[model samples]
Every structure is written in structure tokens, then in C-alpha cells.
Target: MGFFQLLMKKKELIPLVMFMTVAASGASSFAVYSLWKSDVIIDRKGNPEPWENVDPTVPQKLITINQQWKPIEELQQVRRATR
Candidate 1:
């Protein structure tokens, strides 16, 4: 049988194949995004320059702390008071 017919006969493999394809595509996309977001400075010759020569104008991505959660100490105090 041809490749397509063989694959059709094995219906159980379809979901696994689809999941792997999607997972691979997502990974590739994320890899490209990370590379694009990197701070490497390319020279006129299309090669990356040293880290010291990179432009300082680009803003770095900052990690934000979640302010929604109350402090554990305060929570403990409140719980003790309520009891």
C-alpha cells in the first residue's frame, strides 16, 4: 500500500502525529521569537558584535512582581485575629 493508505489503516497514530506536529511547530515559533528578541547587535558584515558594543537604547524586558497577593505574615495575622 502507498504511504497515505498505510497511515489511514493505522488510525490510532493520527492523534499522536497531529499532536507532535503542533508541538514541533509551536517550539519552532518560540525559538524564532526568542532569537529575534535577543539583544545581539549585528555588524554591517551581518555578524554579531561583542556584547560591549550593543546599543543601550533598547529597553530590557523586566519581570513584574504580582501585587495582588497579600504578604504571608499579614495573612497569618488576619487569620489569627479572625479565629
Candidate 2:
């Protein structure tokens, strides 16, 4: 028999099939809306910040050296001794 004839014979499954169709359509519609909104937001934000326009005269710290490994108590003692 055809698919529609089978469905007609089993009347209880019609509501379940209809509910699934509605749920699937709603989920897909929501997904499309979300994608559209994301695109609109990205377009509105415009181009990203340019990195090439940085001031060359500004002093920049290129390297940091932490050579000392003194304990907190020793540091305090050293500060008192210096004073």
C-alpha cells in the first residue's frame, strides 16, 4: 500500500507525525534566524582595528627578566638591612 494509505490505517500516529513536522520546521527556522542575526551583527561592526599604525617613538618593553628568586622573609630582611 501507499505511504498515505498506511498512515490513514494507523490513525494514532498522525498527531505524532504532525507534531514532529512542526517541531522540525520551528527548529530550522530558529537556526536560520540566528545565522541571519549573526551576519547582520558582523556587518554592522565594520573592519577590525589596524595593527600597522602603531607609534614607533613610544617606548615598548620587549623583554622582562626576573633574575631574583629570594623568599618573602629574606626580601623583607634585605629591605630592612638596606634601610
Candidate 3:
């Protein structure tokens, strides 16, 4: 019999299959989160650079970009009028 057919005959395996799917998804998500939170940086020479060595101007540039992209007040007024 085909693998799917076997699964159809054994209904008890449904819960086990669901549990394994959830477990695998949770493990993968945790791995992605851990990588995102990691501050370790690799240099061009295959050396790890300390977080303190990162450029200080990067944060300042980000702040300037955010300030430049502020939302237009006209759009908010239009939305309020429509409501």
C-alpha cells in the first residue's frame, strides 16, 4: 500500500504527525530568533569582531533617516475628514 494509504488506515498516527510538525516548526523559529539576537560579527580575515568595535555613526545615520521619513500631516487630516 502507498504511504498515504497506510496513514489513512492508522488514524492514531495523526496526533503524532501533528506534534512532530509543531515541534520542528518551534525549533526552527527558535534558531532564527537566536541568530537575529546574536551580536557577533565576522571580519574579512575570518576573524570575529567585538560588538564594541562597530561604527558609532551607523546609529546616527539610522536616526537621521527615520527623521527624514516622518509621515505627512496632510494625510492624517484627510483620513480624519473621511471618517
Candidate 4:
């Protein structure tokens, strides 16, 4: 069941739960994007320099989850079937 439906059943905690959910969603998404964003160093002319390298530990893909592979593989299969 969806969160809104769940909250509707509860009635009293609806506002509280919704507010918390919205705040949590915004905060987490923004915080995660900021943390993983490319930290390129710009020069005085507003050009990014090659010297500004991301740490080796930083991931190329923003998302940490490995579950995305399943869908990607499924898509490839679908594409082949359509040919």
C-alpha cells in the first residue's frame, strides 16, 4: 500500500507523517546528490582544469545499488527480441 493510503487509515498522524516524509525525501535526495557530484576545480577563466580529479574511491555511477543491472539486462533481452 502507498504511504498516503496508510496515513489516511491512521487519520490523526496523517499530517505529521506526510510532513516528515516530504522533508526526509527532499533532504536525503539533495544531500546525496551534493555529496556525490563531480567536484571539478574551475580556473580564473571559468574553465575546469584536468588537475581537479575526483578521488579514486569515488564511484563512477552515482547510485550505490547494484540492483540496476537486472533491469538493464532485461532491456537488452527485449531489444534483441524486437529485432
Candidate 5:
């Protein structure tokens, strides 16, 4: 028998098959929408920020290093002292 004939013979499973097909399609659509949404980045207020609104200045660091460069031993000592 053909696929359609098989389905027709198993009439009890028709609703379950239809429901699963619809659910899968819905889930796939939602997944596609989520992927498409990730491409868009929004601001704090859920709106897109204009280029003019963005600050170009450098931000201050929370932790500042007095010495520009130091040996690994000195750095390890400094880290241990902080702890």
C-alpha cells in the first residue's frame, strides 16, 4: 500500500500525526525567529541607539596598574599581596 493508504488504514493515529507535524513546524518557526532576532542588537530601552548617542571617549578602568610592565615574579607578588 502507498503512504496515503497506510495513513488511511491507521485512522486512529491521524490526529496525533497532524498535531506532531503542526507542533514541529511551530517550533521550527520559533527557532528561526530566535536566530533572526539574535542578528539585531538593542539598547537599554529596547530601542536601537543612534550613532550620535554612542560615546567615542575611552572609559576609565576599575583596576589601574601603576607600573606599565613588570616581571612575572613581581606581578605574582602583587597579586598575592592583594589577596
Candidate 6:
């Protein structure tokens, strides 16, 4: 009954809605993959397999301590003499 009611008034829009839905769903997680083409629906390439294991390289914070201080951190403590 409910399904029939949905189809009753705007019958023409049904195809459009279905097409849009399909396109949306297809585009949700669709990947064109490496060396491929993409459109409304991506033309998938089955040639090369995807990277199974990703070797992530993390960069370490590199610091250099010079012997001389550049004025900023080298400021001497100020002394206030009491009268």
C-alpha cells in the first residue's frame, strides 16, 4: 500500500530518483584506482592490485643546538636595587 502510494503521483520522477540514488551510492566509496578514468560512475581498472600493506614513514623532529645564543634566550636577569 505505501509503495503504491509512492508510485502514484510522480511516476515520471521515479526513474530519475532511481538513477540519482544509484549514482549517489556508486559514488560513495567508488575509487577510480590507479591509472584509470572517472565519471558519473568510475570506470574501474582491474589491472594493478592495490597496495596491500602501507609502510608509513614517520618523521622525527630534527633539532640543532648551536654553541652561541642569538640574543633572545641569552638575555641576562635584570637586578632592581632597593633604596
> Considering lDDT, where higher is better, how would the candidates rank from best to worst?
4, 1, 3, 5, 2, 6
Q: What value of lDDT does candidate 3 attain over all alpha carbons?
A: 0.64
Q: Count the backbone clashes (under 3 Å) in each candidate.
A: 0, 0, 0, 0, 0, 0
Ten consecutive residues with minimal summed lDDT in candidate 5?
A: 52-61
Q: Quote model 5's TM-score.
A: 0.44
lDDT of 4 by residue, 1-83 (tens): 98778777889997787799899999999887765456633353774544345454556565776533223678769868988
Query: Runs in model 5 with CA error above 4 Å?
Result: 39-83
Q: Across residues 1-83, which tens digit of lDDT does each residue of candidate 5 receive?
A: 98778889999888888999999999999776655342345554765544324333432233555635434788669868988
Q: How accurate is candidate 6 locally (lDDT)?
A: 0.46
Weakest lDDT window of 10 consecutive positions for candidate 3: 54-63
Off by over 4 Å in 3: 40-47, 53-83
How does each model score on TM-score? 0.48, 0.45, 0.48, 0.35, 0.44, 0.31
List candidate 6 segments past 4 Å from native: 1-7, 31-83
In candidate 1, stretches whose alpha carbon ends up further than 4 angstroms from where it belongs are 40-83
Error of 2 at 5 (Å): 0.9
Tell me the whole-model lDDT of each prediction, alpha carbons only. 0.66, 0.62, 0.64, 0.66, 0.63, 0.46
Candidate number with greatest lDDT: 4
lDDT, residue 73, model 3: 93
lDDT digits (tens) for residues 1-83 of candidate 2: 98789899999989999999999999999777665432234443453433233343443333435444434788669868988
Error of 2 at 60 (Å): 39
- Tens-place lDDT digits, model 6, residues 16-83: 88898899877764543322322122323752423322222322113434434343332323212321
Q: How many times do residue backbones clash in model 4?
A: 0
Across residues 1-83, which tens digit of lDDT does each residue of candidate 1 receive?
A: 98678779998888888899999999999777666544644353665545434444554444435434334788669868988
CA deviation > 4 Å runs, candidate 4: 1-10, 40-83
Error of 4 at 63 (Å): 23
* Residue 11's lDDT in candidate 6: 99
Q: Flag the better candidate by TM-score, 4 or 6.
A: 4
